[model samples]
Target: MFDRHKSTPAFTRFTYFTFTYFTHFVRSAMTAFTLIILTFIIASIFHGLTGIGVTLIATTALASSYPMSHVLVLTVIPCLLINLVVFLDGGRIVYYLKKYWLLVLTSFVGSFIGTKLVFIIASHHLLIALGLLIVGYVAMQFVAMSVGKNFKLPNTTPSLVISGTIAGVLGGATNAMSPLLVMYLLSATEYTDDPKTELIKASNLCYVVGKIAQLIVL
Candidate 1:
């Protein structure tokens, strides 16, 4: 006459914890899916008008509910796909690769190292760092736009290498590198006349390389 209905205390605790974890996972997944859909549409519109904002929009949307590292990882595929589409549409992939090979190579190296760092860092610290990076990028953009065409950043070898490295690290950490990339390109005197097409092409190429490196590291 064993008690068939009674469960052991350890078994009860295990069941409770398992169910709680499953419930939280399901809720987070659902919320992430919904936010991604909404943000994709909005980001697409902005990306169409300007050659940026897709990753920023997606990362910002997911950052509140999920860890920043998770958001960066999840956005990598989508960002890569979108950049591929844009790169193909422009029909200048070969030209960009040939022209900016050095910059691209350095960026890839930086991104590989940065991606490794993401895993080593704590989740809370990553979130705070990402927040500050986003804020700094926005402020930099505002000031640059306010200053208009007067500002200039020479595209020397050192400048390109430094900017590319910074862009790669930021891209790896938060998946938001367009602000820095765009600013760097815009500041160049050659690109100052009419930068839209060149800017889009260059940024897409850089993003494609960075995303590929991130996927490899991940």
Candidate 2:
């Protein structure tokens, strides 16, 4: 008869939740699952129709409802998967891989370094920075295309090499590097209006190269 009805610890009481706790957990999980599906649908539509990067569409759509950090991680899976699907189905992978060898090698090297840096920095700011960069790059490209005026900003070799490096590094960090990559590809060619297509091509080639290198090194 020492303690037939001893009181439970507050922590224990909380851990041994009643029916209400599980109900709430299930409800929250269902809500999150629905939101994820919605975001994926919107992102897929945007990418398929306009060839815009999936990360851009997915991040913006999920930003309001989901934590930015979570969205960023989820974004990478779809982006990479979509690319893999396109590569396997379209038959362009082999051709482009051989064509843009330098861009591919440079991106891998830069991305490897960038990935390490990302682990050291805070997560919240990463997505915001990437979003802003995308918006800004798109705006600039639109303006250039409208004017249809050739502005000799810099030579292609140095600019491509530098931008590819930066894109790989930033892409590795935030998974939103497509905007920067697109910007670099646009700068390489005179026609800014057609950057989305060109950027997609460049990215495909770079990804193939980077993956091969990663396989070997890692």
Candidate 3:
């Protein structure tokens, strides 16, 4: 009677198991939380030093442990804010928009479609594809440097639309469009007056729209 009133054997064992599970859960949560904090801190530092890496770094780091969809959702807001700061601070917005409105619109469409595909396709396949894409980009860059080839991007309307659409799809799927954007901008023969500013303005415009689409979709 006294044992029953105090605690039955089954109840005591269950209580112990629950406590142990809760403790493990808290520890795991804290560890993940700390890792996220450090990752973003480093990502932001790199972004400040260079003009890129906020979303790329954060997404790559977090996606290693989390689901791609969750990683995308987590980084969207921060990426949006960062892109907005770069874009708004760059100024000459009207001229840039006038020159690149088609690119921007195409990017929006591509990003929306790509983001929607995140739900349609299995994320692990996308993750593997993303890995391959990054590797391919790096390899291409290395080859270009080895061959001393300056890739000249065609400034035709088709090229502009195609580049923007591709960049947007990649950005929506992986959130690492900075490299393509940089490559696209650097290859341009025009915009030599203030290439850095123009590049930042153009890339961030696409980034802003892409993030907005992500927000809308997810």
Per-prediction TM-score, please?
Answer: 0.82, 0.73, 0.90
Number of the top candidate by lDDT?
3
Please provide, for model 3 over 132-172, each residue's C-alpha lDDT reduced to its tens digit, 9 standing for 90 to 100.
77787788888889999845567777777888888888888
In what order do the candidates fall by TM-score, top score first?
Answer: 3, 1, 2
Model 1: per-residue Cα lDDT over 1-218, one tens digit each: 76645657768889999999999999988986888888887887887787777888888878887877677777888888887788778486787788878778877777777787788888778777778878887777688679874334568888888888888887787776776666677654264445677778778878888989999988
Q: Which residue pairs of candidate 2 clash?
A: none
lDDT by residue for model 2 (37-64), tens? 8878887787676655565666667765
Give the runs in model 2 whose Cα sits over 4 Å from its true position.
1-17, 63-69, 145-155, 187-199, 207-218
Q: Which candidate model has the greater TM-score, 1 or 2?
A: 1
Which segments of candidate 3 are over 4 A away from where they belong? Answer: 1-6, 147-152
Candidate 1 has an lDDT of 0.77
lDDT of every predicted structure (CA atoms):
0.77, 0.63, 0.81
Candidate structures ordered by lDDT, highest first:
3, 1, 2
Error of 1 at 65 (Å): 1.3
lDDT of 1 at 185: 74
Lowest lDDT sum, 10 consecutive residues, model 3, at 182-191
Once model 3 is optimally superposed onto the true structure by TM-score, how far is the C-alpha of residue 203 displaced, in angstroms? 0.8
User: Which numbered prediction scores highest in TM-score against the true structure?
Assistant: 3
